[model samples]
Structures are given as C-alpha cells and as structure tokens.
Target: MTLAKGCTLCYQGAKMVLFVTGRCRRSCWYCPLSSERKGKDVVFANERRIEAPEEAVSLAERMSALGTGITGGEPLLCIDRVNEYSKALKDHFGKEHHIHLYTAQAPTKPELEQLAGLVDEIRLHPPRECWDHITDTDYIASAKNAKEMGFDIGIEVPALPGLELLIPALPYLDFLNINELEWGETNAGEMRERGHELADGVHNAVSGARDWADELLNHGKVHWCASSFKDSVQLRERLKRIAENTARPFDEVTDDGTIVYGVLDLHPGTRDAVVARCRTFLTEDEFSDCGDRVETAWWLLEEYRDRIPGKKSVVERYPDGGMVVEVTPL
Candidate 1:
C-alpha cells in the first residue's frame, strides 16, 4: 500500500510533522530543522502547507494521510492551530482517523483535556542531555495524563551516541522511538558547531544514532525501532493506514522532477500528454521542475513508452512529469 517516497500519506513518503513554530523554549544542538524555520508557524509539512483548515482537511485526505503527526518548534505554542487542524481532519475524515502529535511542553489539565478529543497519540522529544533531568515523576506524570485521556503516548529522540547510561530506566516510558540522527543542509552549521559528522553511507542511519538504537533495543524495556526499520514496518504500516483511511490516486514524481508511467521515457515526447495530465490532476496552471517557464517547449519530454511485441509493461509516471513502465518481452 506504500505509494512511493515523498508521496503524501505514504510512510517515508510524507511524515510531515508540521514544525509549526520554530520558536522553542529550549535550544538543542542536534536540532536538525535548523534556526531559519523556527517560530514561523506559517504551517509546513515536508516543505508544503495546506493552509486553511478547510483546505488542510481535504488536502490531507487527497494525500491519503493515515495520521497527521502534528509537531512544531513546540506544538504546545500553537496548540490552538494544531487543534483546529486536527479536529477539522477528523471532521472531514472520521474518528478512526489516526492523529498524532509531538511536543516537549507538558500541557496543563485544561490543554490535555482539550487535546484528548482530537489527537490519537503523542510523542515527546526530551533532549538527550535532559534525559536525566526527566524522571518517573515528571515523565510518568505527563504520560499518565495523556494516557488517561486515552492517548497512546510515547517518547522519541535522536539516538545520540553515548546515551546508553540512561537505557536501563525504560519502565519510565511505555514506548521509546529512536531516530537515527542525521545532518541535513538546514542544520549543517549547527551540527558542525556541535562536532557532529555525517556518515559515509545513509543506510548506516547517522553515525552514532545507530549505535544507540542497537544498545536500547537489547534491553527490551521499550520498542526501539531503528532507522533501517524493515520496509514492511517503515513504509507499509503507515501507508496502508493512510490508504485505508483516505482515497486519492497517487502521481509520484522522481528526484529529477519528472513523472513516469509505463516506461514511456516521455523525456523526448510532445509536452501535450504531460501538460494534459498535470492540468487534469495536479492543476490547470502549468508547472515545470526544470525552472523553465510553462510555455518553454525546448524541455518538452523527448521520451516515450517503448512498445515491444508479445510483452507487457507496468506503467509508472515519474515526479518530473515523465513516464516509466516495467515490462518483459516474451
């Protein structure tokens, strides 16, 4: 059921936890989202925003979102906006809609009570340095509060290299999800300042991040899902969820920004089909990833779906407005 990477609602496709407000009360060095996007509560999920609550509901439905994980510079700051978005989604969709959120700010009794009606689950990201500061008293207090509200609460954090010292105290939290820490262009400067380096292979799941995840999983106090978590676990679980929750035909684009269907390699064809397709499904206004104006014909796809006698192909469109099909000749 996984549509594809970057596809809406697809696991690994668009786990766009809205970094609502970049403004955070605490400053962690490993903040990969970086400083530029902080406190700008304009609303963004994986570089895109649905804007209005009405539009967001429909947009999320179209993208086949199983659950909307509302995060933020700190979700609590914009709890009102997040609550609006969450409730709107449930209204457009239904109670079955799986809605989750991330936060560090422990909510008050009133906030928790209000959030209970909207969110299905919540994950907390307390800094690794702050792990010791959090104890059964504070951590469990928040967890119990959310749990009482019938929310599946858990903890998420980057697998900072040397945090095994804190692993033995797993009974403190019901579920702990460890993200393989990685550096991105947005946070490169901060990472360098913090003396973090990128690993040679992406599969390695950040340099020290993997090492910590392995260490945590061994104890079994909490379920420590790794970065290379199985495709069935990583992609299928949530995608199947989103797919089952909403209905939207997918149009996957490639890194080159071309769409493919049936291996037509329309990279060399008339722009008619491409333009028609986008105008029909994506939008009436023409758009191109090549930075060329919509009217520019020079970059018209010159590719086409290859046809062979006595063979069939699986047609797919690339994100770049081109086509691809996998088939066998018999």
Candidate 2:
C-alpha cells in the first residue's frame, strides 16, 4: 500500500515530531500522551524541550529531517504557534519540506486560511462517537474546505469499531489512516473499564483492533499502522538518524540508535590528578570533562582502566546527551 507523504517520511525516520503544546481540548479515552506532557503547556522537538519555535529548525536539521508532523493537545487550538513554527521550518528547509498537522477540531475557513500556505497536509481526528454521523458533522465540510484550499486532507483514527461508518465521508478525503489501538499509561484504566485486553502479553496493542480494519484494507486510500511497527521500526529508524548526526568519534552507535561510551566517575578530591593523568594519554578530543565525570572511548578507557583513578563504567544512552539506557561497572 502507498503511504502518505508524512507516513513515508515517518517510516524512513525522516519526519521530526513537533509537539507545540500539551493543552488539548478533548480528552479522548485513548490519548497516549505521557503524564509529563498531558496537560502541561510545553513544547518539544522530538525529545528536547525548547522555548521558541525556531528551535525546531535546528533539531530537525540534527535528524536531517525531510518533513515534520505537528501534533499536540490540539494544534488548531493554537494557530499562531503553528504558523510561526511552520513558517520557520519552511523558510529554512524550503517549501518541499513536507509538513502535516493533526487536529481533533474541524477547521472552518478562518483556521484553514491561517494554515493555507504553511501546512501541506491536515489529518482530522473526529471523535469516535461522531464517526457514524461524520457526514452530518463539520468534519466533512472541513475536509472539503481543506481540499479546496490546496491542502491534502485525510482522517486519522485509532483502529476501533464503527470505523466502517466513515465510508460516506471517504469521497472527500485524500486518505484514511487506521492506527492500531493500544494501551496507554493515562488511559489504561479506561481501557480496562471498556473490557479491552492486550492482543499479546508483550505489546500494548489491543486485542481485535486490526480486525476492525479487515474490510477497509482493500481500499487503496486506506493505511494501517501496527503498534509494533511504530515501536520497533519507526522509532528505531528515527533514533538511528539522530545517532548518526549526533554521535561523537568516541561514541559507539548501536543498531538500536543508542550510543555507547566509557564514563569515569570523578571524586572532588582526586579530580585534578585523574584528569591530568588522563590528559597525558587521551587526546583533547578523545574525552569530555563533564563537571562530575569524564567520558571517553570505551576501548580507550578499558586499556587504561588500571591507570585511571576513579570508578569507571561503560554506559549506553540516547543520543544528544539524552537519558541513559544502561551502565555496566568497568
């Protein structure tokens, strides 16, 4: 099946996720937003928190992004923020940098007008209760309006029952994306309340979710995103891209996109002598002297383990000084 441009970029790990705000208007039972960002008014470029819209440009460049996906509590709720960031990206990356936005609210002429030149695509997420009567809601008109306004319009919804009811609205859409329904920390209780169980013991995918899309698969415009695929393929690809761009000469990039390096835990009393000793053997670029620790090539640290004076370990972590994944005492 042909993927949407945004989906294509995502599968290739070329799309940077730009989270503008965490303040969503609707509280969907299946919202997977983390607790740290669920209702907080925060902005994130992938995993890095930033204060300005322009910061997204640098982060996108770090991952060598070809496109970006704007998502939030609801992006339409803050049109100006959307406009600013989209404009910054387009200005820096040019018009060919594909941008798609996700919104639960249907856009009228005004909202579509604001997004007209900046956004390349718009994905509507009409609430499940309205799926059966989507034609009667503003969503259909929004889709039609969005299409006429030169934006590729589509509907994106979790793979759930009653999706077939959206058939009547299909003629107005460029595509339909059905995401595998999955358990989320915030909605796990609600999911259990609805009597849903994991499709398997391992992944968060809900049982029978894909069955809901069995008939829709035949349609050329329809696409199904499995939870496992998102977690394993899409995320791994994105991480690899980041690792390639951010990894230093001393850092070992793994297939999973994490970086491995040796760390020297320093004590206040012996920090200077240890650093002096390290400087004799390690080149200026071979190690980074963090306030409390020193990081260098894992093999270099291994070879000089007996010579250095502090606790030492091999550490694997996310790129760009991100969270540590593992630490083994050396």
Whole-model lDDT, candidate 1?
0.55
The sequence of per-residue lDDT tens digits that candidate 2 reaches over residues 1-330 is: 667889999999999999988998798999989898899888999988998877899999989999999999888878899999999999999999999999999999999999988999999999999987889999999998998889999999999898899888888899999999989899999999999999997789999999999988888899999999988888889989999999998999999888999999999999998999999999988999997999999999999999998899999998988889999999
lDDT of 1 by residue, 1-330 (tens): 211112223345434344456667877766666445755656765335547777666556544565566776888887888888888878877877677777877666688887987887777776666566566445557877877777777777777765564564355555666666767656667777777677655543455656665666755444544556533344434343344444212333334333332212234354455545534433332233322112211122222212211122333322212123332221
Q: In terms of lDDT, which candidate is strongest?
A: 2
Task: For residue 19, give model 2's deviation from the true position in Å.
Answer: 0.8
Per-residue lDDT of 128 in model 1: 64
The count of backbone overlaps in candidate 1 is: 47
Q: For model 2, what is the C-alpha lDDT against the true structure? A: 0.92
Give stretches of model 2 more than 4 Å off. Answer: none
TM-score of structure candidate 1: 0.66
- State every prediction's TM-score relative to the real structure: 0.66, 0.97
